[model samples]
Target: MNRHLDTFADSIIAGKRLSEGEAAELSATSGTDAFALFLAASRIKEHFLGTGIDLCSIINAKSGRCPENCAFCAQSAHHATDSPVYPLVDEERIVACAKEAEAAGSHCYGIVTSGTTIRKGEELDRICRAVRRIRETTSIAPSCSLGIIDQETAVTLREAGVETYHHNLETARSFFPSICTTHDYEDDVETVRVAKRAGLTVCCGGIFGLGETAAQRIELAMTLRDLDVDSIPLNFLNPIEGTRLARADLITPLECLKTIALFRLILPEKKIAVCGGRERNLRDLQSWIFFAGASGTMIGNYLTTTGRPAEDDWQMLKDLELTAGSCRE
Candidate 1:
């Protein structure tokens, strides 16, 4: 183990944060040094956040016909991907999905819609109703990822019992145009701000490996820290066939672990729930996420792809002796 890496880790454990240059150097670690880097992150997580793991599930409540042109998304009508396209499901269906998630030991159930935003209409009403019933019928927390929300919508969702709001910044401000252009970076920032003003916990994080540089990942983490988000869902990009990023190279499993560790070191006590692209991106090394300092992960189907069976995840957790984390507690 590199003594310098150990020293840096100690500093973080002592509440010392990395400067931008220090963050850049850590992001560049690999081989044996990388091992030490990840070890430090795991230790920090165990020390500061405890060994608790937060597991959540998301249903693609609404699919496709997205107006934005994010290069990494198959749901955009701008792309010709063979993804399912549909309006928001009925309240009954949404409630059923939430119950299924709760039954599977998920602490939170998220309703993610594929659009620039869900305008105030029948879709929004159904989503609000679904959020209410999930709370009334089950012991699970309800969250929503209905893009670019205004203060009024955030208040409405909060009134309907939505505890958390999900909106990703997707990439660093400097690199934003490369991944998406239809929406402004500030548009996302504003929504997170609005949701927070309405007393909603913001669950925000961006996708990795969309051709962003290592420094850019650090930049994204710093932004999330500044936002004081309640939870951060780190998603590795899954290059969908029809999306512009299909030609983008796959992020290696080692790099994925490194990024998770990086997020943990940067955010410290904040909830780090590793979400989409774990199966494809991490492959055989999926269990390393906990060691990399992730406090939780998403289970069941992703927005555009199938996830490993929930039983598989449960068995993995049992083998690792990691417990499922709950927002309620």
Candidate 2:
């Protein structure tokens, strides 16, 4: 099995794409075979991405009252969770957070909001101003998650010094209707295309463990490959209380690692970041993410939940003898 895994990894390194059947086979690995899979993924990662890893931090520029009904989201107005509800923060605050994230060794600083789409007038202008200020004031690259943006908005953000535009498909196309009903999966896909058309890099991905089958996870990865996104942020379900999936079973640590490895094999050359539920889902095995083929992670507080201290993440990287690398570069 290890030899088979190594051969597959070599093929991927030689520019072969993993088919859906191969990905599903990799997803079914377990026990010692799973460890072999992780090692193979690590080899692929080192080959394409090197040993250096990227660290990113995001500020919830706007919070709560999201009209979309993503089942795993606490910020959705459709769910009665206690996620923070507020308008977009002032430009000063947004720029200040970017500086803070830079000080914390983050390569990218994201300005994330909580609505279906940011308003065109005051909201868009403020975020653009903040992004310009961030570019002028900090070394870290600026990214935005304004949601379901059109080509004009994507162009505007690119002109404002925004390096990347983020919009998640949230789940597999086959399972998207079960996770979100307020919007179509195609909207998110088109947003990625629009951002890319406007000459902006796109960081797009989805959360797992939303009662999705392993095949569905592979399906999502294949879709991402077709989209040709620059970065993929893989999140595990944290199950916020009061949301539809609050009582959903937590994915096991090994399963989480397997998911990471599967994605690495499927998207061998893309920037894969383990974000959101790393602490809760991976727990003591958080350090193993790099070995499982993840090349980056979100270090600061998530959109609603607080992450572990940045010092801890830095120490983890140190312990692993990995250096922080830039995501945009």
TM-score of 1: 0.98
Q: What is the TM-score of each candidate against the true structure?
A: 0.98, 0.99
Model 1 vs truth, CA RMSD? 1.0
Per-residue CA lDDT of candidate 2, range 1-329, in tens? 99999999999999999999999888889889999999999999999999989999999999999999999999999999999899999999999999999999999999999989999999999999999888888889999999988889999999999999988887889999999989888998999999999999999999988999999999999999999999999999999999999999989999999999999999999999999999999999999999999999999899999999999999999999999988867
Model 2 ranges off by over 4 Å: none
lDDT of 1: 0.91
How many clashing residue pairs appear in each of the predictions shown? 1, 0
Candidate 1, position 171, lDDT: 93
Pick the TM-score winner. 2
